[model samples]
Target chain A: MERKNLVEMVNIHKWFSGVCALRGVDFSVGYGEVVGLVGDNGAGKSTLIKILSGVYPPDEGKIYFEGKECHFSSPREARMLGIETIYQEAAMVPKMSVMRNIFMGRELARFRVGPLAYLDIPRMEEESMKALERVDLRLRSPHAPVDELSGGQRQGVAIARAMYFKSKLVILDEPTNNLSVKESERVLEFIRELKKQGISSIFISHNLYHVYPVADRIVVLSHGEKIGDFRKEETSVEEITKLMVLP
Target chain B: MRHTLLFTLRRALLLREISSLIMLLVVILVFFALSPLFLSRENVGVVLEIIPELGIVALGVTMLMIAGEFDLSVGSLFAFCPIMISLFVSEGIHPILSIVLALLLSLLLGGLNGFVTLYFGIPSFITTLGTMLIWRGAVLLISGGWPPPFSSALPTAFLVGRMGIFRASILWFAGITVLLWFVLERTDFGNWMFATGGNQVAARAMGIDTGKVKLANFMLCSLLAGFAGVIQSFRLETTLPSMGGGLEMEAIAATVIGGTALSGGVGTVIGTVIGSFLIRIIDNGLVMARAPSYWFRVFIGIATILAVILNTFVRERARKMRC
Candidate 1:
């Protein structure tokens, strides 16, 4: 079987202020594969994902998506290229409704009538309902304030949003960070579901247990350098944890 | 069945505008009971007359507040625009042309407010406050601390003339309210406004230009403020140097009373219209009831605090009910 890369970063480097966040590092995710990126604090896992998400451009590197070299100047540009990023804290506005959160920047507007084009409320509500249904997440209403949702359900909403948008690569930055044990399991299950749908995911987390079961491959970083890469059958959680702790 | 009832009840009280509507009705009733004169046609007309200028300015402030920004300069620009118009008209410019020039200048003022804040990375509150003082000083200097007189039947008739018992400014106010309500409620741009204020970083991540939305809001605020100034001047047939002073506070208070969050991202145009009316009617009603001039301000202050307290309590209940 030919193993093709869906996303590839070649010798990426990043610096914040004067401190180096990511030294020379290379990372990739294969099509329909869940790549678990694990690291301790200050390991540059976030910087790498941020680069991929277009939160910050790498000071030095090349990024190829779907076999095409791409330069994304902004997160919007990155999203337009089908790269969706779910940040830990900033995924959705708390005060806004779930439907509004689903269509925040990419709202569906009715065709222009006279000089005005209005929000297609009914269509958005219907589509949001369908998207949430795809994730098997049931909300009291699509109009419920997102702040009212449990941490786990919020992750579901974010996942559903990416799935509905047909994103090629969904980057989950600590998707299960603050969720309960059961909710964390749900996120892991959702990742497996994504693999079944041919959608690739880069699942970033600090917990090996959270990522190990669902990930097809585990990538480890220590002090901003790629320390270990292993297939599920090639390594144990103990070994990966050791790699993350050691320089 | 209990779940559905909670949802429905939550929706009703959680809606900020509905509460404001209730407040407006209650205020009117109380005022009418205290002074039968409050409900009289002539007294109602007088209250209506006081509303358009204050309401227009408040409309601009409400949108800016919704976008998570403030424009203290609106009142100064409101006074300045009329001064500019009167100066131009006195110098042999056509009244309509003078009005247009004044409005164009107002757009610049608005742009400056947005640009200074964005460029310096300062809070808009501070930036607009600075501009407010500067523009107010500019108005005084240009007018020599005196009101400018005018006598133009055409400009007056067009901008502020009576249509039956109501002034033309009231029509402009209603027209603006309708237009802004449509923009805020129905348009994609309105969604962007809420998103921008709701979470600017998230908004930017999703490809929305949060900066542009806020800048446009600032400009719209100034344009409306200028329009109010122009209307008021044409109505009075003169421009007072003291006009529009302290009006920014009134506008901000009204917007908050309308349930626009001070932190931004949540507001309604209908709520703001009711809020504006509630504030202005109290001011008029107090005068009719023979209260001292200073008493109205105390009442306004108390009313604003109470309105916000009431709104927050209701919203909290709804949130608790949601769980």
Candidate 2:
């Protein structure tokens, strides 16, 4: 049986200045699939995801989303197509309220006259609480700044934002880094929640232990090249770790 | 029960303007005690009249600061706009047209400042610093180091005319403050400003045009500075190249004292309004108390430092309480 692919990138190549970052990398995510992208430092995991998320355009390749060839010039354009990328340590504006952070780029305006419009604060607040509840995150108020939330909670907010936006694919780059043991568990649980909703995600991580439980398939990268792609049932954590570290 | 009490106290202290408000009250009380004439009607009116000039400028600076940028060139633009207005009027342009033209020039200069800062990837502080010198020199060259004669028959009464005990400029200041407050607190642009200032990387990753946001703020800051200069010139009926000299520092000080962070992403126009009044009152109170006018700078310096320290301490406490 052939699974339907939600996103497919074929022979993607990226170069920064004169240094090659990715060389003809072919990656794809199936419908309702979680792909744990594991690689060592400088293995091009981030570069590949950055290309898919529209942070950088691939020098040579094509991206097909839902069987349609797509071109993205900016991150905004990609987001408009139901692709949400949560970059590590760049998820939410710390000084802004949770509700504001949730609706940072897409705000609900009561009425827009020219460029001057009032925010629909009541509706935003109500929706924010509902989204947080979906992730089991209860706060005293939606007005509290995200800076006050714990590390795990911040990731929860980003996940909730992706869920609320009904994103077709969420690419999380190193989402579990810098989190405590318990907090990492919560983030893994979020990946499960995303999968339950039939939302596909690319979970990039250096820790195999963290990714093994949540990811349905594991893809290993070595120095800008895809070395192995295996279903979770057919691969072990030790096998992926060896592939990531082998020269 | 004790935790609830601590939480309430921390929350109150965490309010952005509370420290500045407390400082304003303290300064007012100390001045009133030292000199009974500090609260006299005439002296109060004098303070009110002077505050709008710097207050209006600070309001713009506060907005720009919240967007995570700085404009040290505002003082130069303040003087430059009015001089241009005077030059236009001398060239037979209608006073209204002259004012509008000068304002447009201000917007252009501000946009240039933003363009240079963002395009070259330089700090706005450095970018505005260079433009500050350039604009100041332009003012000197244009005005020839003297006050340009402004037309007294330009129907300026509507702008700076006296209404009972208050000048119309005061009303302008209040109106601008209210409008900007709404824009900052209730609008989508306001949220973008906070996000852009708070974390540029996060904002960009979220698909916001941080460069555009900063550019808009830069233009706005210069426009307000120019407008403030126009108000002053209308009141005085003259334009001086040296006018608003050193005013950029005063406006920055006012914003800092009002709890606007130097690092950006946190600030309020209302706090800036209180901050402006606080600075002016200190200046006027020293005169009323028969103290050297130089003490005004000393007091402002002390007030700015104290307000920041208090705000930081309170904010740190609130953060700890949350955990």
For model 1, the superposed segments whose C-alpha errors exceed 4 Å read A1-3, A113-116, B1-8
lDDT of 1 at B6: 75
lDDT tens per residue, model 2, A1-247: 1336998999999999988899999999999999999988899999998888887889999998887888889888888898999986788888889999999978889998688779999999999999989888889999988988998899999999999999999988888889999999999888899999999999998888989999899988888989999999998988888887789
Compare the candidates by DockQ and give the number of the best one.
2
Model 1 lDDT at residue A61: 88
lDDT per residue as tens, model 1, A1-247: 1337989899999988988988989999998989999999789999999899887899998998888888888888889888999987788888889998899878888877664578899999999999998888988789988888888899899999999999989999999887889989998878877787899999999999999999999998888898888998999988888777775
Q: Candidate 1: lDDT over CA atoms?
A: 0.87
User: Per-prediction DockQ, in order?
Assistant: 0.71, 0.83
* lDDT minimum window of 10 residues, candidate 1 chain B: B150-159
